[model samples]
Target: MSFSVEEGEFFGILGPNGAGKTTTLEIIEGLRQADAGTVEVLGMSPWPRNPKLLPRIGVQLQASSFFERLTAREQIRTFASLYGIPAKKADDMLTVVGMEDKAGTPAEKLSGGQAQRLSIACALVHDPDVLFLDEPSASLDPQARRNLWDLLRSLNEAGRTVVLTTHHLDEAEALCDRVAIMDHGKILELGPPATLVRGLDSATHISLATGTLSLPAAREVAGPDASVTDDGVTVTIATRAPAPVLTALADRNLLTGIQVRGATLEDVFLHLTGREYRA
Candidate 1:
């Protein structure tokens, strides 16, 4: 329940639906009040909100609202004017988000991903020191999601602190420097992706394709503490050590098209949460 995000770090908050991810972010963003917990962001209490701190942080909510009839350029310019940001800087932000080509296009005419990028552009128009993204790539296609990931990486490289909420385990593994896994309003786990995934178990996975292989025979050959599953040709062996299994299979002339791999975050998540990360 208590945590801190260091400067220039890409921190991710991950959880399933109704896990209080959005609620926690809303509390930090000064949009919601916490009854008991003490919250500090950049050395300021986000609840009794500081006027100066508000302008120095950029926030992209899960959903946004804008004048549908306004062009992307006009929308940015309007936000800039409200914040007293220069017009040229607004255009530059639009260009940074790859929306310059669509600047003349109305918000209603923009695609979901494009509109999301424009929302992010507006959030960054004032050059804030901290950025919050709430499921920024939720509706985006794979390539568009990658583009947004690259943009966020560039922001982090430029020394901006980013706090993001995501349900995509792979995206968290790829983009986060450190991740906090939350559930039921509490932090269940926190650490770098690699460290967390490696903490699950000291085992390697070996997969093989042999066309309707025998699961029981494979398990017997894999020895104790190892498991084998066969699904009509595709076989997967989970073992604490792969060398012994490989040797046994080789000795039996059963090791063909074998591949050894390490555990990933998805595997760890499934092990801990008892559910697949579908979002």
Candidate 2:
């Protein structure tokens, strides 16, 4: 329920449904008011919706409604005008989000991914120092999702702070410098994805299909987080360094049909919440 993001970091909020992801984002965006406690963004309270702060922060919601008849360029220009910025700023932002080629396309004609990019363009048209996104890649195809990641990374590199909420663990792992995992309206874990995953012990899961051998507790080889699951003598162990465990098991001729895989953000999530990131 509590965490702080460093300026200019790609901070991600991750959680399942009913985990308060969108509610937290809405509070940060100044669109919703919290009944208790205090909230701040960019050095000012957000609940009151400060006009000065509005121009310094950009927000892209999970869903956006655009003027269907307006060309993407026009929509962005309208936002630019609202901020008293030059209309040319719209073109620049569209280019920044990789939507320049589709600038003239009607909003109704753009695909979901393209429209999401346009939404981001509109958000950035005012030259905000911070960008907020709620599930920017929610429905994007794999390639589109990757493209969005590149855009976000480039924006951060250009000195814009970004805060986003997403359900994609891989997205958080690949892009966020640090991530906060929430459940039941509480932040249960927060840290760099790599560190959290590595902290899960083996940082790798080894599954071996042994024909008829029984092995010592995985906890003995790895640690408490290490465990074994059996399917016809197949044992799975979660560990940080597999070499030592594998070598020790090999000494007993207990290794068979071994498979090794590295840990991931998904594993960390499951470890913390005992549930999948279905939400």
Candidate 3:
């Protein structure tokens, strides 16, 4: 619920549905008013919609809205004109988001992912010092998602601060310098992804193709400290000590279909926020 993002830091807020991620972003972006706590962004208060702060920050909401009947290029140009930016800069922004080819396409005709990219371009057209994105990649396909990630990384490297809210744990791990995990409008944990994952002290998971070894044989090989389970498709060995188990598997030639995964951001997130489904 409370944190500070250093200058040029890539900070992420992660949570499940109804966890107040969107609401928090809205408050920080000065789109909504907060109830009680004080907020100081870039040494400026965001509440009451400070006019001086508007030019320094850019915001892309979960859902994008555009001027009626405008093309993708027109939509961004309009945004640029508000900040006294040239049309050329707006065109360059379209190229930056891979929308140059679709520049002439009507806003209503753009797909969800394409529209998402356009919205990002519009936000960046003004060359704001800080950028805020909420669920920016939710509508993107895998390839598009990777492209957006690359774009964001480049922007951050250029000394722009980025504050993001997303449900994707992997995105937070890949992009965030630090992340705050929220649940029920509260921060449950805040740290670098690797540090938080290590703090969990969780077990390693070594999975093999089902029937590679019988359940009884696997139990015998893994020893008593390790827990083994098979749900027909895969046999998983959960162990704090993986070296011995891996050696055992290698000795038996059962490593052909093996998969090994250590604790990750998702593990820490689920541990803190619970595994139940959220609508």
Candidate 4:
């Protein structure tokens, strides 16, 4: 429930659905009143509706839409005008987000990724000190999502403080300097992704997918403590030393897939929360 994002840090808030992330963002954005507790952003209190802080902060909601008839350039220009900025800066902002090629395209005709980039352009048009994005990668394809990640990193490198929420644990691991895992309006874990994941009981995970017939022998080699997935096709061996486990499983030719990796954020979350992350 309490955390602070350092200046120029790419902070991320990660949680499953209905984890109060949206409400938390709204409160910090000065769009909603909090029942109790102090919320400070950019060294200014976000409560009581302070006019001076609004202009210094930028926010892009999970879903963003512009006038259907307006081209991407026009939409950005309109926002620039609202912010008392020059129209020429719209083109500059478009280039920043890789939307210059689509500037002439209407908002209604733009792809999901293009539209999201335009929304980000609008958020940056005012030149705010701090930017907040909620689930910015939602509905984007894998390639588009990765592209957005690159854009966000570039923004951070250019000296912007970005706070975002995401359902993808991999994104949290790759993009965020520090991540807070929240559930039911409370933070269940908080730390850098590597530190949090490394705190798990097992240092590594050996995952293998096999048929029901191989489950018995797989568990035998994996030991009594190995975890068998609910579907029984997947068996995971957790240990710091995976050599013996790997050697034992190598003899079995029924494995459809096998992988050995360190404990991940997802593994830690499942251990802590006793459930899979649902987004």
TM-score of every candidate: 0.90, 0.81, 0.98, 0.84
Give stretches of model 4 more than 4 Å off.
208-220, 224-240, 247-257, 273-279
Q: 1 or 3: which has the higher TM-score?
A: 3
Q: Of the candidates shown, which would achieve the greatest TM-score relative to the real structure?
A: 3
Among all windows of ten consecutive residues in candidate 3, which has the lowest summed lDDT?
248-257
Per-model C-alpha lDDT, please?
A: 0.87, 0.83, 0.93, 0.82
Against the true structure, whose lDDT is highest? 3
Which residue segments of model 2 deviate by more than 4 Å? Answer: 207-241, 244-259, 276-279
Q: Give the least accurate 10-residue stretch of model 2, judged by summed lDDT.
A: 210-219
RMSD, every candidate, angstroms: 2.5, 4.3, 0.8, 3.3
Ranking by TM-score: 3, 1, 4, 2
Model 2, residue 157: C-alpha shift (Å) = 1.9
With a 3 Å backbone cut-off (N, CA, C), the pairs that clash in candidate 1 are 212-233
Give the alpha carbon lDDT tens digit for every residue of 1-279 in model 2.
677878889999988878899999998889999878888787898878788799899999989999869999999999899999898777888877778899899999998888988888888888789999999986688887888889889889998899999888889999999999998889988899988887875357787675434555554665565566676666777676678888877886767667888978888888777755453
Residue pairs whose backbone atoms clash in candidate 2: 1-187, 201-240, 202-239, 202-240
Off by over 4 Å in 1: 210-217, 247-259, 276-279
Q: Is candidate 3 or candidate 4 better by lDDT?
A: 3
| Tens-digit lDDT track of model 3 for 208-270 | 888889999999888899899999999999999999999998899888869999999999999
